[model samples]
Target: MKKRVKQPTADVPALDDDGPFAGDRQFVGALYRGLEILRCFRPTDGPLGNQELSQRCGLPKPTVSRLTYTLSKLGYLVYLEDSGKYRIGVPVLGLGYACLGGLRIRDTAQPYMDELARHAGSGVLVGLGGRDDLSMIYVACARASSVVSLQLDVGSRISLARSSMGRAYLAGADEAERTSLLQQIRAKVGEEHWPRHEEEILRAIEQVRTRGFCTNIGEWQTEVNSVAVPLRTPRHEMPALAFNCGGPAYLLSRERLEQDLGPRLAEMARKIQTFGST
Candidate 1:
């Protein structure tokens, strides 16, 4: 057998390359690096050491150490003596809660989402879309039955390749932005597992574009099913936000989610958008 070394593809870039932001002066490298470090701490993650953070962020170990120390001192991150590692501190939660508190959409969407969730016996969520790897974050979530959905709320992150909310977002994005995000997803998930997801993601986005909504049937999680629609806010922010309705797979099967609940979600999205404009 012959040995082969796979080279990096131009489409999938290294973390340090800066890619599109190469010479954008207003883009502060240091601040971006710090935020990147903060984002590395997922709600599911345990305390992480500097070495792990360095590898995850693709930054030098020394830089990660300094950044971690600074974050710790600022109360944005905290060190654990037993673990000899750091975890997200209370201040980060304050920041996320603060942002959610001021969001006009969150306030506007809650009542409707609660009503919808009650009727559908499912979960309804509003997600903010972004170009970043964890592409969407839950801003408002309403669950009628805790037993029917996972415990996710404001600040919960979801992958762009798997969630119905993410597909709706991608369907609403411009071509260049979509391509860039797909490339980032490929780089993050790696080549071996990207193809299967890539095919399904494209198909779902196409469906979203044609039908004005999207669906996920046991894609992100085998026990989950969901449908979503993009909301065009007055601001028209890039990678505009999405609204989703989802629940336990047994209760929110593909047929039910796509056929019955999907249009309801899409309607809710429109109403929310209208509210945002007003």
Candidate 2:
């Protein structure tokens, strides 16, 4: 299994565009497989061979070969002639830049995100659920007072069902959208533990609706806790965004975070909403 210790260092995530289609009449199998191949390359996974791609994508070696060939020809995947492996290529970058350039959240939320980081002496970030991966990607960020292992930087991706940011995004999303997102998340959790996981996420969603924010305590990362609230801006596009503040669990205990920081986060979100509305 890939280690959860992986943390992003850069402000930009690895790619652009959206995730693969679920079940649609228009769903193209070839396109979905191509995307699956691209998804296989990660910051941790690095490059891959045909066999490994087959294993990760659950596709046959022959099919994988054909897809990789097509992708390589399209400049979406570059083949390493010597290593006999494939990695992401440049055209993917164009998609990411175009998507990111169209966003306004970072411009409006940045100053406040920084201030919250300083006030809480913890990392503060704003991100949205990716239409591409179902993960939330940080578009704006503020570092904590001290150096820490938590990797909440710009372009860093967080889980949809686990992180406070993710829960906030889910809570803010409309019913049809939230249901679709939850179905995707439930698949990721798998069958064995999904029942319990689903209940916990439902409670968090309720809390966000009633109490104004959500909390993450050693859920996504060990010994880390966070508070988050959903943000609603004008235009309010798909993959609705949210804000979160987090630090080591040692520094921000569960009780302290819920009692103190939680309200603060809700207030910050409201302020941002007001700021966006004007």
| Candidate of highest TM-score | 1
Candidate 2 global Cα RMSD:
8.4
Per-residue alpha-carbon lDDT of model 2 for 165-278, expressed as tens digits? 888888888899889888887788798988977887888899898899888888878888888888777665623678877777777888877888789778877887777666
Across residues 87-167, which tens digit of lDDT does each residue of candidate 1 receive?
999999898777666677777878888878887864443334333464688877787755446677767788777888888
Q: Pull out the clashing pairs in model 1.
A: none
- Candidate 1 Cα outliers beyond 4 Å, as residue runs: 1-20, 122-132, 236-239
Deviation in angstroms for 29 in model 2?
2.8
Best by lDDT: 1
Q: Any residue pairs clashing in model 2, and if so which? A: 11-154, 16-96, 18-132, 19-132
